[model samples]
Target: MSVGKLPVIDLTPMRAGDEFHKRALGDALREACVHTGFFYVAGHGVPQALIDRVFAASKAFFDQPMADKRKVDKALSAANRGYEFLGGQTLEPGAPPDLKEGFYIGEELAEDDPRVLAGAFNMGPNQWPAGVPDFAPVMMEYYGALLELSREIMAALALSLELPEDYFEAFCTEPLATLRLLHYPPQPAQPLPGEKGCGAHTDFGGVTILLLDDKPGLQVWDALNERWLDAQPIPGTFVVNLGDMIARWTNDRYRSTLHRVINTSGAERYSVPFFYSGAPQHEVRCLPGCLGEGEQPKYAPVTVEGHLREMYRRTYV
Candidate 1:
């Protein structure tokens, strides 16, 4: 695999239940995790129809006039959700806004819950656009379905860690999840100095499951080689990557390489990502197998909520 290029791994047999097939799946995952935090997961049982419906709805949503979409602006939630207009985002420092617009969604939890405290990880409620008639329903349905699929994937992760497949269950119940929809218009023939669809940055949560349209211009950084590499979307496949917490939990056995999106295409590009995170207040520590032997604990334990608050405060505010 080229440097900065996300490896494409076929995940079919990994989901298989036969005891005879377990080792193969484990090996595949182990290689992927340790080498490249990014991979194309094909053969995971998510329905094509659901994925299609999501992208289709995304197109419709982005096509609406900016004013119409802004009717339910995230200004209320302080831009935690709702819409982000083109040239309105940047995760990289000293860079212009990303050449894209998007909607960020997450699980709806009670504001009074401890998880919703000012310093809590899941404090924000969703900011929705009332203009789109079925927006809420469609999003909710898609989220529920993806949530199940994510849990199944997490089970495989548990197995890979040599623990009971239920290792990630604690994070799933009342999961702190996010669904982000992105639209990137084509870059102008003569582009601005530092604009990109998305700046190079690593995710701050657990794992991110992304559904990208069949477009060119997305790239994942290869830690091995310092360069930008393309991430082309394949039909019927989803891209998965580890975030900060998962990388920390594994004692850096897994790599969380920095990735970015560039609108190199002559035409617009669109992508939707469902970010699965955990209760911010939960403490994250290296699992026993990850750092028990040769690997000494590289990082001390930190509460998820506190870590999240610090990250968000830096990024958002």
Candidate 2:
């Protein structure tokens, strides 16, 4: 059971009717947000049964023959909106490609939305497998719920940072999102040069909310220890971590750590991680309080479109 050191915080019922409950959760978030930049979110309203259903669907989808899954492969489309099978690189330099196969889907958008058409990665329509019944709709329902939950957490983060509760709300409406259904098959009989379940790369979105199975490959870098620390799954909790965009918004106050997935034990693993980001057209800049009065801006303002493009350039090329 010993994987590695990790952090967890229980946020049960932050929207409780009692005022004390709200303050306590907010205070806890403030402390953890500043120190860890990642924590477990419990008491999030999503049902356990719903999660189990999604996990089941995910496993069934990946269980199909590789050739069948590739029929909907994301590589087949310029939209980047379908399956990215096993052995895809993380787009980081020198690091190895991930050993997992994934099904990536984002919000279905109309071309008229200037932001969706212009922004990369997220805004396109998802490719559904005609063979799988109700697959797309159920996944969409799950995504919708997580998006709502992310918004609530963002409000709390804003309050923790001593900013307006809605400071991030407007900019995040219909944000760019990704619901990645991942499956890491057992380690190959012979390993590649640098292959692992996934390479070390900080998430590019505002925050990553992950629902992981009890597989032991997921590791988050411990800044203080400077080592790859295991992140064991706790049932009833979603592991939430700050990503590069949130780091920028906070003026680097919070961290964006290097995390990787490695499975030396030869176990097949599955995880569903939701990458929640700002609205496609929103511009991200350091908040006033984070910058302080008359203090120099730590980061230049950049639109979501520009920031993501630069990230893709750095990682994809």
Candidate 3:
């Protein structure tokens, strides 16, 4: 069954064990994944109060003086945790730098942790901004909530792919996830050519769960029509999209479509995107049922860490 221009899926059924409902959930997810790689998920159990606190903390932190914000700049940590200045990244090669500032948060590990000692890529203690009192607590709480929700979504994805519900259990263990808070200023009247709040690019991880403010700016590419479709924000729901790893795992059976943002709402826009990249050591190979008879895997196997490192190199180097 088609779910309109962009599907709005209910996760409430996925939380229960009724076979019929589970299968129906899987079917809906499969439709979204195979077609647009985007959907809106409702009935996710995160509290609205906690979501509000997160947004409030984000704005409070961003409103701080530049000197205070720069104290925890991402450059201070090799693990890529902390604040990122506006235009710090260019997601689309050859396009102007992205016109947004962001902050990154990840699992809190101590300096002497084994992972940190081993110099693991993007693995280390998070640097918290000092001035925003509620920033640390609210963000950590929201991160925990999103992390658990992502595992449930991953299970649904496995079911959609005709695999067992726990097919990604190993992959979810000790996953490498990132919670990013972004602020996009209004689009300039005469912006630079190809400039945007974020550039046209596919995400690099397994999945992304994005929370948006009431302003519309997100857009997903409609490859079939060769046009971009606005992804309007809907209250009480989060926009979900697949990433490159899913496409690779399915041998391209599922899309990891290109998307971007442009803050044309004439006001600042704030969003939170949780990137659920599975275990750093998990081996990402083509799934068993993804290939046709006598067809070989299109890409060689790579560990999650290896894939992430390569993607980071391409974008940040």
Candidate 4:
């Protein structure tokens, strides 16, 4: 029961059609959520070839000159797409800017889409880099695939919470998902005081599926022990963690722990983290079984879009 290290959960059982395996997997997921809120997931059906292709495209895109990458600056995109250079944002309030660069992509909506017409935030076209010819295509493919995987995982999570498997379907019809490709350059031997690759903060969405390179830099704060534990990368698997929205939905039964990255690996570190959340218009309320007898709800109902907009305002420069 010691939640010292992140747990590894095989997702194959949940994906399989066996009811027994599904129930078992749900049980394990429930425990992991309550204890650690983070885990390593294997057997997640995404093809390794597809993952590799995306990584390759990410590197190629980041390898471009600063001017080339800046052509699609996120500041120019109303939908929060495009590239963000190092120090453009700070995840942890009052901390120095993050020492990393990243490209953000989301579901590409056309100008005529109803959501776009309504001026919905985060519901418009993504800005593709002209320098990397194959970056857009490869990233789009990965996004479409991961979106489906996220739904499947959500179903499993619903079951773990003692709700019907399809309980979350309504909230996902127009998911506000984001696929971020991040590159952390080799850190200086003596970094400025208070500088970090990514500052300590909890994700603002529902779940994060992270694929990291072998070089170690990510660390999770162990609140139980008041210490930082390395989230070492594992081959052929991804690190999955719950986000603040999920913690709120479950009335704090699950954790949304603080985590950060420090790239002192003496090598450039690349990571792809897909952040999946509910539809912008969906209202997140406390689930039925989350509150114990006579326990008051810890949070008020909030719309996904409103929460995201506020979080973005705080983080972006």
TM-score of each: 0.90, 0.91, 0.97, 0.96
Instruction: Please give the CA lDDT of all the candidate structures.
Output: 0.77, 0.78, 0.93, 0.88
The digit string of per-residue lDDT tens for model 4 on 1-317 reads: 12246888888876675978888888989998998799898889999999989988999999999999999999899888999998877887778889999999999999899999999878789999887778888999999988988898898898788788899998879798999999999877888787899999999999999999889898888887888889888898999999989999899999998989999789999999999987988998899899899999898888998877777777663
Top lDDT hit: 3
Q: Candidate 2's residue-wise lDDT over 1-317, tens digit each?
A: 23563455555544653556666666778777677677888878898888988888888888888777889988775668788867775644675777888898888766566755675555666787766667887898899989988898887777677676677888678688889999988777787777778887898878899998877787777676666667778888998988898888888877777777787657788999998887877888887667656777778999876788788787766
lDDT of 1 by residue, 107-163 (tens): 765566565676445456777676666777778788887798788777767767777
TM-score of 1: 0.90
- TM-score of decoy 4: 0.96
Q: What are the runs in model 2 whose C-alpha is more than 4 Å off?
A: 1-5, 110-121, 292-295
- Ranking of models by TM-score: 3, 4, 2, 1
Off by over 4 Å in 1: 1-16, 109-120, 292-295
Model 3 lDDT vs. the true structure?
0.93
User: So what's the TM-score on candidate 2?
Assistant: 0.91
Residue-by-residue lDDT tens digits, candidate 3, 39-112: 99998999999999999999998899999999999999999999999999999899999999999999999999
Clashes of 1: 4
lDDT of 3 at 181: 98
Better of 3 and 4 by TM-score: 3
Model 3 error, position 71 (Å): 0.6
Q: Is candidate 1 or candidate 2 better by lDDT?
A: 2
**Model 1 RMSD vs true structure:** 2.5
